[model samples]
Target: MGVFTAADEERQRGVRRMKTIATGALALMATVFVLAKWAQSAGAGSWTGYVAAAAEAGMVGALADWFAVTALFRHPMGLPIPHTAIIPTKKDQLGRSLGDFVGENFLSGEVVRSRLSAVGIGSRLGAWLAEPDHAERVTAELATALRGALAVLRDSDVQAVVGEAITRRADAQEIAPGLGTMLEKVVADGGHRRIVDLVCVRAAEWLEVHSDSVMDAVTGGAPGWTPRFVDRKVGERVYRELLRFVTEMRDMPDHPARGAVDRFLSDFAHDLQTGQETRERVERLKREVLGRGEVQDLIASAWNAVRTMIVAAAEDERSELRVRARAALLSLGARMAADGRLQGKVDGWVEGAAVYVVTTYRDEITSLITETVAGWDAEHTSKKIEAHIGRDLQFIRINGTVVGSLAGLAIYTVARFFGV
Candidate 1:
């Protein structure tokens, strides 16, 4: 397809106008040369000789310049002259040279780094982001990006990845030590006391409400030979003692039973931490739980829940998560804008990253430029370039004509003065 655009067509028209003007000047010079020669031959004025010489030189200069300008884009007069049609014939070489120039200058690591450092991009960005409106806009854009990323992800694939990662991590690291340490801390800080108190209160309440059931359970296990009255008395006594112990434990926080319970938990925590058998049992239980299909399903479902929550929050402009994220971003931006040290750090990071990329891919980038230019059709490229610059080249022909006329007239005058 042709690459000639409307703008190129306009520029071509302008070039044609200038060309016509310059060619007309050449034609006028030739006519003046013929007329002045005839006037000199007829013994009209002595100045006619000088005029004829000037016009002849002007025509020669204009034609020479026209040939030079035309040769750049195409062969002059359609003749296959050597070194003519320079642009069309040498397009690939020119592209390579241009690519090399860019790679050596603009795409160099030093140039890129210096340019970026001078721009102060980090500080300017920070200042812009420090504004409330700018921060809001950035937050909205980030939310949109987050939603798009989530939407592109396949749930089954992500879930499988997440599930495998969790399982692998859990299997690789033993949890007994951490759990034991946490339990020990909780016990030491009396964090489990409230739980103990709750258990005691519930036990007492159950005993009070189920006295008959408790007594019956105690008496029903008596031997058949035992007297019915003795069994009944024993059951009643045992039930009363059990209810009283629970009531005391519930009412008194510093009861001996509470201390005993604390000691038992402390010992259990220690065993969990240091006892080989206990750790092995815990590990076995962990393996069993993880091996269960139900547990696997639950683990996979966790990803869905998280994805849903994040998507919902991203979609909601007024969500707590979004609001907090926006506030955090604004705060960070304000800090970055005001703190010179942070700005410098950011600038250094950006410069380093840019330098690294340019240096690493400099060859590839330059090759892309060279290959793209080489792929362009040479004839079309010549036309495109000539359209941009032909009008300016026409001025050269006009200038050459004027300068040649002046030079020729001066030479002719000197010859006449010397009586040549």
Candidate 2:
């Protein structure tokens, strides 16, 4: 009772009623055969002989059909006859055959593609998504998915992965040639002039403020034999020359010192591009910068910032990221719904993806069916199947009884006409 569904119970009752009717028919035939034989023996009529023959055939047919039907589920009359209990004994084989049939026919790539293509999934999806409410639902679902994904990720693992990727990329690419090209472009465009002017101005200001320090440095480097006043005068002259040169460079754009600074930059840029020594020096500097603990920390922290930004955007309905995503989806949906070419492309993609999945996992799918069947108890399975189709099978028995009687009557009538 626990195993049977309510519908199955109803079917079982119907089966029992049919079985009773079939058995009654068989019993009726047996009684008729007995009466007809008795009458014939008493020389009642030739019709009694025919009736006995028909009744006898009906009984034989009914018993044969009853055994055939019962043999499918269990042994008839509890006898362990060979080939009886077919379903229970051969359940595993049947399951395997069913699985193989499905795998070969339904799960094939061609079948999957054909079925999905006929469904027009892409066009239907586009039509559904074209609606504002549907678009909003999709947008919300996407946001939730994004949030869930970010939440599941460990920050430290993400940080480490980001750091390693950045480091590896940087290590693989040589920066000197690229840097030189940029420098050359800047110099050609006179972008370096402002930088030079700023430096010159800053130097002039520093020299003006530390004139005493400059004089002392010059005098300290003088020969000890020189008079202190001469050394002091020399120091003053040196300091004045340096200050005047910086002032000229700062004020005059066409000054010789400015021209010299430009020439120096031009030469350095050229060396960066073509000189091996210059490139090697740049490479060394690059390695040093990349190898620093502070740079690694900066790279790792970038992932944290990006993760935070994305999570915030996903959480906020009004955020630009979500708003734009929703808008874009709506637009795409509308376009796809309107454009046939796009619809075709989308359909093709979907079909190809579906076909790939089915082809790749067909074995697994079939195994699931087969294994589930194999796990069922054989006797239980037999009973379950019987509950479903046992009522219909009773019709076969009923038909056999009626057909057998008619056939017997036809044969007897032919025999009497032939005078047999």
**Cα lDDT, all candidates:** 0.91, 0.89
Return the clash pairs for model 1, or none: none
Give the clash count for model 2: 0
Weakest lDDT window of 10 consecutive positions for candidate 2? 1-10
After superposition, the stretches of candidate 2 with alpha carbons farther than 4 Å from their true spots are: 1-73, 201-245, 376-420
Question: How big is the positional error of residue 338 in model 1, measured in Å on the Cα after superposition?
Answer: 4.6
Q: Per-prediction TM-score, please?
A: 0.80, 0.73
Model 1 ranges off by over 4 Å: 200-260, 291-301, 311-338, 410-420
lDDT of 1 by residue, 191-296 (tens): 9999988898899999999999988997899999999999999999999999999999999989999999999988889988999999999999998998898987
Model 1 TM:
0.80
Error of 1 at 52 (Å): 3.3
- How well is each residue in 107-189 modelled by candidate 2, as lDDT tens digits? 99999888988988767888888888888888889999998999999988887788778778878988788888888889889
